[model samples]
Target chain A: AQTVTQSQPEMSVQEAETVTLSCTYDTSESDYYLFWYKQPPSRQMILVIRQEAYKQQNATENRFSVNFQKAAKSFSLKISDSQLGDAAMYFCAYIPNFGNEKLTFGTGTRLTIIP
Target chain B: DVKVTQSSRYLVKRTGEKVFLECVQDMDHENMFWYRQDPGLGLRLIYFSYDVKMKEKGDIPEGYSVSREKKERFSLILESASTNQTSMYLCASSLVTGGWYNEQFFGPGTRLTVL
Candidate 1:
């Protein structure tokens, strides 16, 4: 079974600054997908970024980017020019290339944007 | 815009009561999932349906059942609600493109309280 771990339970970043949330996972599969999701208070959970294991290049979307290290089994999310709207609970999830198409998620990191 | 909506944002129920949580997606996705979120635990999959009347047990399916009579709607049922079952329930939908899966779109979530 694959397990995702988010060591940081809470993270805070000043407005307009940058923040990085750490995540690690255990999986033997060579081809898979890693994802970062954000859930704001009383709001829907949305996809932040995604990285494919076969792709060496990291994934970037707007202010959100991912540092995916396949060898280390590490996938981290970096938020640049953070704003108050970035304050939310962030989760790291994993899914393989094949099979049931279910996601395995980490415990999550609560991000706080300090103004 | 792709939208997945839950029946309620907040629900209160007593122990042993039968609870049903409804989810509907406007995107005509082929896959739908149900998950539960807790403070220290990330989103745990409870059940998922690939097609109408085709359901599969996810990571945690105990005390929970699901129904997918229609392509756009999926329902989760708690045969006997318990305090341990009180948590935030989330519904998600995604498409299967050429045997590959796409990123999931989530609902706002329903917070259920079992007293």
Candidate 2:
């Protein structure tokens, strides 16, 4: 079984500033994947970014980037040029390379953007 | 665009009552998942189905059951609803084509409250 953890329960960032949400996972598999998902007040879960375990370079999507440290099992999400729209409950998820397609998610970090 | 829709945005049920949550996807995905989201528990997988009439228990399936009669629809059922079962239920669907990096699209979620 794989588990993901988000240390930060809540985070705040000013508009146009940057913020990072911490996440870590426990897995024995050599090949797996990590993802950052955003859930807005509308209750829609949207994919922010994703990184493959085999890839050394972290994944970046527009203003969102991940610092994936496979050795430490840490996958943190960095949000740059933050906007009011970025305020949401951000979750870190893990998926193995085989067997199942279900995702294991972290406790989540509630991000607030101060305008 | 892949669209996943849940039958209800909000549901109120009584304890010991049978509760049903419906989910439908438009992309004809091969996989569908049911998850419960709480304040501290981000998303706990309840059940998942890879194909029609094939369902698998996830990490948290003690009080939940699932049905997949059609390729596009997946339903989660609570045999006897309890106060502990009051949470946000989310449905997601994804294709198995992109190897192990398959991405899932989620619905708006159903907030169920058991009294």
Q: Using TM-score as the measure, which candidate wins?
A: 1
Clashing pairs in 1: none
Docking class of 2: medium
lDDT of 2 by residue, A10-111 (tens): 999999999999999999988888889999887699999999999999999999999999999999999999999999999998888876656889999999
- Candidate 1's C-alpha runs over 4 A off are B97-100
**Deviation (Å) of A53 in candidate 1:** 0.7
**Chain A alone, TM-score for each of the models?**
0.98, 0.97
Q: Which runs of model 2 end up more than 4 angstroms from their true locations?
A: B97-101
Error of 2 at B41 (Å): 1.1
Per-prediction fnat values?
0.64, 0.59
i-RMS for every candidate (Å) is 2.5, 2.3
